[model samples]
Target: MTQPAQVPDATHRSVDVPGGRIHLVEQGTGPLVLLVHGFPESWYSWRHQLPVLAAAGFRAVAIDVRGYGRSSKPRDIEAYRMLAHVADNVGVVRALGEETAVVVGHDWGSTIAANTALLRPDVFTAVGLLSVPYAPRNGFRPTDAFAMMGGPEEFYVSYFQRPGRAEAEIERDVRGWLAGFYGVLSGDAVPPADGGDPHFVPPGGKLSDRFPDASLPSWLGEADLDVYAHEFERTGLTGALNRYRNMDRDWEDLAAWDGAPITQPSLFIGGALDASTTWLADAIKAYPTTLPGLVSSHILDGCGHWVQQERADEVNRLLTDWLRSLPGRARP
Candidate 1:
């Protein structure tokens, strides 16, 4: 795959992993810093951090996470499983000539980064999680909780539990679905702390119906949206949405890591308006306890789900500061 034409200041490359070739963008020269993006986003999601980390004397590499952007996109639900994705990430670090990398991720990517650190500390020496908290595997299946829901209308994840359903609805208007995902969760795009906007779109309704914003946020320009739209159009959302489909299987697969604490130097950053803080409040409160090596945790006031993108400077500052603070690594 080639580099995305739209994003600036980075070079794209691919790493051959167990399942397929993984696409990524790289910058700089020193201890490696790996950035993993979340759903509906690409390596461009880390556009701000790449240059900054490079400038601070660290090699920064951001990837498409298998199912997105210039990377290989597999159709099966099992392909998006976290362990497989984790293996690909570990492979990226080694493929890039580093025995270990400072792994950082946002949104669903945070879950991937945390799992990698927990299961393969030898490969991921340190971790930095954004938006999502790393909760210890308690042998509890999240899919079972969704199963007890009154209906799919209760939560979007429940709605996404079924394969082929969300893809049919959202892919019909990929741009709108992307816009709605950004709009509702974004602080600037919606009222602050209103709680009036619906988080889950009921069946038969277009995803855009939940996004009351007349237009996309100013920061996310049409040019940026085009980059994502083009990539998703090529890959389709099947592999991407497959992450949500395997929650039960992921839970069962992670039983081995149950009660295991993430025993690596870690940093966490989140936006105050990010819904994960409220919806997953239990995990947020238990973050330090679960992640024994948490060096710091910060939530930027007045920010939202797209924390790294929306508040790039703050995110960069927090990240670089944490990188400098970590105990001396053999590579660093």
Candidate 2:
């Protein structure tokens, strides 16, 4: 695995959003591209992609969202909700003197990117999503993994809603948590041939019982691990954890739009090995089936949850290709 180019030349800027100031790092110069990071990560997650995008003749800006990194860390759980996240993106784009940008988001950031495109389609020319799909609101019902995956294949998302338990477990052992989270998707452990085992789930669930010695992929060196560890250690897990807590609220807020569709040209990129795809399989199928505007979907082979970082070459290729295909003010 080639190491990412260590370009520590990000120009920091802050924008006043509704809740607080959002910190962002802008580098390179060309057409605008907003790179958003996800849970348990900061803008550092896009270290590889930033310079590549910049070199491709695009002005790339990676943000620390609202609560992560040097950004404003709000104590209130409500402040980290979906609408607030969407507004932050809009505010950043406007503050940076751009009308529309190609929004690229991964993991939890994917959720917000989709919401931003839907809530303010005018702000984004296109969207590139990694890992998670656009979750549509369906009547504001409380749905769990058990309801979606039957009796045995439960405990994945349920682990997130366990009320201070997941955070406690992860915070107590950050390295262990990072290992478990990345290990499952890195193909270190053979998945059950017949779907997933009743006991197998990502990170803080039952899988830890079976694979006590599991470690993160060799691709993730100690430096990478330390970056994630330091951020989560400083910020604690509340900000990231609050994302799960607001699912119901998000569902309710989105419930008003019964059949809303994502009109923006959108792309779905996921690791062929990641289990998140399995969890949201139904929604993915239902999306294009219901809303025909979803342009393309790509499942990258030999990758996991951290698709962009783990498979930077393939990801950069796809992103550049997609950006080139789009009709924009500037072109390479």
- What TM-score would each prediction reach against the true structure? 0.93, 0.87
Computed on alpha carbons, the lDDT of every model, listed in order, comes to: 0.81, 0.74
Candidate 2 yields a Cα-based lDDT of 0.74
- Candidate 2 versus the native: TM-score? 0.87
lDDT of 2 by residue, 128-213 (tens): 88898776666546554345553544565555666587677778877677666665566345453445543345433453443335
Winning candidate number (TM-score): 1
RMSD of each: 2.5, 4.1
Q: For model 2, name the residue pairs that clash.
A: none
State, as a TM-score between 0 and 1, how close model 1 is to the true structure.
0.93
Flag regions of model 2 displaced more than 4 Å. 1-6, 143-154, 188-212, 287-291, 329-332
